[model samples]
Target: MEVFSEYLIFSARYDVSMVTELDDSKPEIKAVTLDLWETLLLERDGANEQRNLIRCRNLARALSKFGVKISVDRLISVLKAMTPWLLTVWEKNREVTHLDQIRFIIKAATDGSVSLREEWLDELSSAYVSAIYELPPYLNPDAPQLLRWLKDHGKKIGLICNVGRTPGFILRRFLKDEGIGNFFDVMIFSDEAGIRKPHPEIFRMAARRLGVKPSEIIHVGDNLRSDVWGAKNAGFKAIHFSTRKGRDTIAESDPNSLISISRKLGGLKEEEIIPDRTITSLAMAIEGIEELER
Candidate 1:
């Protein structure tokens, strides 16, 4: 959690034939690297976001058709009430569960904000508005600043996303929506690769496409094995994005315990602690890399 500056020596030795490419004309993309999900597109960790709020709103709207006539303001109140329970659900499954049923139950629960029917309401609408809005480190919003900064230093950027079930389609949609699709030279997704991180092949695939030896590229991500060790072992510069949440409590605890907990949770690793560079915010990441070069 403590972002420390440590010098590291990286190994670079890649066998080329083992790497296959779909196209050789993509400028050997100067930097073929990335770890998607939390690294680039950050959805709200808890329930407080535009999409789920709207999801609740849409559910309420649909229930109106069923003669339940719930006002959006009242639905907003319901969403506010649901926010506390939202964390419980996230901590439980890391994904929203039974959304329609939950909202309908919320409308009906005496403990819920609006007490309507207790037993059963008709089926809620199938309008899932989960991916409505996206947060920052967006490809477009600050691109002129970020791209100008990254471009000035002659670093090419690409994505190396490790998705569990979400495919490249979702990733592309998010990027395209943000209007920053032009930034990445290549986009790699776990679903597309049929292999997940801690596996060397995926990294190899990225390096191959970039036409640069892995050693020349630096991979930035939130995960340790997928982003750090995987790239480190594959001979690329590995940088870890240690978040404040992971470190805030540790700021008070003994550093050893912090390191231990981080390791256990896959956030901290022995080699990871000593990244060639460490960054807390992507906005500052390019600056950090410049500082490292200095």
Candidate 2:
């Protein structure tokens, strides 16, 4: 989750907003850009769970190539940081999975008493095993309700992720496992692209795949730099999903101040006919877009 706070400002804003619940009555998005990390599912802080888990898995796989052996506990430690957030995955599975179970798995895997087959040990050297075992899980169950809403509303959706180490394959697999794969018109992973957010090219690429000009699309993400700035630069409508409640107060404290803050944060200066509008929730975004047509 390195640089995650900066990456997920859009989600953070939405998290703060005490607005109408998520809805999709008059969806106008020719396409949608989703920021993977916090926007889709959040991993535990400090663990780099998603990436490290893949490294562990890959390292084990690579070691097997060299005839190295490994232990399950070691494999578990490598995968400890990864936890499945069923709520975020399944459209119908909104129930939260117990965190304790996740914790227990990690603790047990890291516990010193576990052992593995000698042949497995031979294939996986201690150095590789330790590195892999020390990695974490990609656990996040935020549910596919948002994705589902977009899909059901007849909008094309795509993923635009900014990740440090996690690969696009993992994200693809994760999304597919959550049953949201069918919703995306395209998926853009920074790792695979070699270019990250704030780069208009990435957003533009996704828009290209959807067969629409960026101007006709709406990008909903949790970042100011990558999501807001980049989307606007690419000529797409940008909406800030401020998730907080007191923002209305903040905005009201001095509408000018809010305007100033928004502009400085890569938002429109209240008077400027800018990238359409800003919203606090997916539900509001849907409504606002509809209102624009009215």
Candidate 3:
């Protein structure tokens, strides 16, 4: 009986060792894709609202210089009005350009009453973009380190981002200035791609751009629906960066914000949709991906 018990224990330990070896021998994941806001970039409580106000004031002042007078308060209203229209575009998996957004704001605010010359329009665009510099979102302290780790390990890195008031073009410049822009092999913005997350095509698009197969790529982001569901449905492995609460404002009253929040709030069973891995900090992403590969 003692000899039989010893044999059973030896076999069990040997099997576990073999399984671990086999798991480690699995093919390594080829690439990593990341979300922009709240993943790489950290948001402050009131930074966004303050930035929006600065934008409205900047544009209003620029208009005054061009001999077109519009109240800052009216500009604020026009800006808020864009939330619904912008949300509509996003819902359809389409994105509107920055220039179009600018045109919409001016047209909606003035009711076609004040048309600026082309040069004046150029000035207004600068005024709007400059607000970000004055009141900007800070980077995640873990971002640079993770990015470096991926590069060192020879993994192709890319960005799958959704832009709000700040457009893709501006974000590229911002990332470049932030000193980590060179890490990405490709960057796809919803605005430029004309598609949003939770839609599988966007993930596939990033894979194609990086010249990698979907199965060989892993994506990390904060939103479950947008990043996890989107990447997995599109055939890529995903890691849920649950450190950030979400991009939705807690008190947001915009119809779009409400609709987005409701989906998360409305879902009861948390496990109905699950990510391949969930990490509380970006630094753990390195080990998370390794585990996924295994």
Question: Candidate 2 residues 1-294, lDDT tens each?
Answer: 768877587677776344434342333457767776545554443344333455456555755565544454486453543333321221121222222222333344547343334454434333232332345334234336666666777778878876433446655776676667767889887656656666788888888888877867887665565577778898887766555433333344544331112223434343343445666555566665555434
Q: In terms of lDDT, which candidate is strongest? A: 3
lDDT of 1 by residue, 71-118 (tens): 666655655555445434322323333443355445553355554343
How well is each residue in 1-294 modelled by candidate 3, as lDDT tens digits? 999999799887788678678876855689999999888998776676678889999998998897778898999888888877876676666778777888888889889986656887678888998887898889999999999999999999999997777888889999999998999999999889988787899999999999999989999988877788889899999999885354554325343442243235223356776999999999999999989876
| Candidate 2 whole-model C-alpha lDDT, 0 to 1 | 0.55
| Prediction-by-prediction clash tally | 2, 34, 0
Over 4 Å off, model 3: 1-27, 115-117, 244-270
Cα RMSD to native, each candidate?
13.0, 18.6, 6.1
User: What residue pairs are clashing in model 1?
Assistant: 28-210, 34-160
Instruction: Identify the superior model by TM-score, candidate 2 or candidate 3.
Output: 3
Candidate achieving higher TM-score, 1 or 2: 1
Model 1 — which ten-residue stretch has the worst lDDT? 2-11
lDDT of 1 at 260: 25
